[model samples]
Target: MPRQHITTHIAILGCVCLGLLAYLFHLDQPVSVYAGTTSTAQDFDSPGSVSVVVNKQRPLGDPGYVPAVLIETGGISLRQEAAEAFAQMARDAEASGVAITAVSGFRTAESQARLHDAYTGRYGTEVAESISALPGQSEHQTGLAVDIGASGGECSLKACFEGTAPGAWAAANAQRYGFIIRYPAGAEHITGYAYEPWHLRYVGPDAAGKIHGAGITLEEYAGLYEPPSAPPSSAPGKNAVEPVP
Candidate 1:
């Protein structure tokens, strides 16, 4: 196998092994209950739904579908609720001296296709698939996923952004505003993408809080999938812990 592929495989295994150890260590504790208990299959299956789980394994319920309503905020369009929530999150972040910028949102199927094609051309199929979602399998098509950046443009869209003011702030607080770092670090294998600190997906406050609080992926939260092990939650205030890097 190629060196990079081998490295990635090792990283994935490391995360799972760490997570299993954490789960075992915390076996005496009760796993947190999912707050979004009412979420149904349609919630994760419909593109227009707030809790939709579009990914490589689950394509959009309807291809080429457009959201019923989209609203522009920070020069990017998103579903109405998501736009409003993001706007509030930005406002609060700015009040705390963290500047948040929206780099992309609400892509059409044609746009996603072009973006995927571009990545595939530059990186080849396997790498491209890990970095970019195919057209109908993208969360952006639902207008709930947004790529964020810092106003100063430092480390924008880069992994290093996770350490930047905006990125750190969002990672710690986005869930309070109904969003999550969709493809979080250490969960690339489960998420089917690399760690993208700039990618925030809104799943409503209830779902976001539960997922964030538990330190698990949407697949695990929605009962679609689970990694062999779970790392404890590292978020400061959350009681649920998982073993993670």
Candidate 2:
């Protein structure tokens, strides 16, 4: 082969190598780090696990499942792991001058049915579904979800609670304790629920961090639902700070 031809081939090979290196670098980017992230190093496929996702599209892993251990906090109960986190978060919020309290947690499937029926009866099926979960399809059934309010009872179980001090504090700090606002505003399309600032789901701190940092719902973090190209503009009730979770 001619020397000039051989030199050209070598140059082309060098360019190809550089291109491959660039591609690899792109793959190593921080956002690419999420390729390895799913409910904090665990995917959402395990219904019996802490990372399980319960929603309209999915139900608890086992219909008859109940937490092996349930702990109470302020008259509400959560699974052991979640209860601890819940207590810690409330304490931290109180230290910060925000008194938060849990209003509901660890519901039986039968209880969920009664609540759903009541809501459906009063408000119709559509409104009931937006706020209440069907029996086996509730995260509360997993003992990992809790609805909270201010200690003073300000805005209890109401969207206006977001404007309350306790609500503000939880919105900012819930992720630190392995919780996320399950139904964030503007994400109703993806979450199949309305914006409920008080509904918190504990998926573990590791998973919660990724979900909070990414400004996505658990379903989105789990690769279960794809957000729209342009998300709708739904203003979070009153105080809109920390709208991600």
Candidate 3:
């Protein structure tokens, strides 16, 4: 072979090697880290990674007040029949002596923004950003979520009900009521928000059972649904942060 031809072939081989190295480097990027698991670490590592998907409904407007009495003292009024079923499940839990209650129900966009601002006020903008979702980003805006507990007390804003008996009971039996924990501990990697045991999302009995039984985040189960909607607002009523049993 001619020397010139041999030199040309060697140069081409060097270029190919450099190209392969660059590709591997790109694969090692932080975003690529998500490729490893159904629950990805990078998904919730930062605020920008969190994104809201618009489903059956558009994002909500400012959240109006629905007297706390209506949600906590009175009863959790639900627009969807599935929500009513959830209330019924709470009643059944009450029979078991669990004493379930709704702490937070439907929340409006403005209400959610206020809550977020409050958290940020105390916890700084960046940290607060991770712990709380923006108004439109919150499931509470969707009115499908209800924070449950042992009794009606202050639970909204931020409460780690996972440790209490009622919290534990709800965690165990939420599926029966068509409710899911939504965000479980250790899954901060998958869910952008922190672990919220009291946050129960109503997706119907079958979905709730499957999600709880499978031990996965709503984001993952979201794929099972034909389409996914936004999260619900604070309790469908007025504030005062009541605990959901």
Q: Model 3: runs farther than 4 Å from truth?
A: 1-77, 152-160, 224-245
The residue-by-residue lDDT of candidate 1 on 1-245, one tens digit each, is: 89999999999999999999987767645443344442333357677779888899999867797899999999999999999999999999999999999999999999999998998999899988998888889899999999999999999878999999999999999999999899988998788989999999999887888788888888777777754777855576656656688
Q: What tens-digit string does per-residue lDDT give for candidate 3 at 87-202?
A: 67777777887777776676666877888899899999887876766766666655567766556554543555666667878888878877787778877656666778888776
Could you tell me every candidate's TM-score relative to the true structure?
0.76, 0.76, 0.59
What's model 1's overall lDDT? 0.88
Q: Rate the local accuracy (lDDT) of all candidates.
A: 0.88, 0.85, 0.61
Give candidate 1 regions above 4 Å deviation. Answer: 1-42, 228-245
Residue clash pairs of candidate 1: 19-230, 231-242, 231-243, 232-241, 232-242, 232-243, 233-241, 233-242
Worst 10 residues of 1 by lDDT: 32-41
Best prediction by lDDT: 1
Model 2 misplaced stretches (Cα beyond 4 Å): 1-40, 228-245
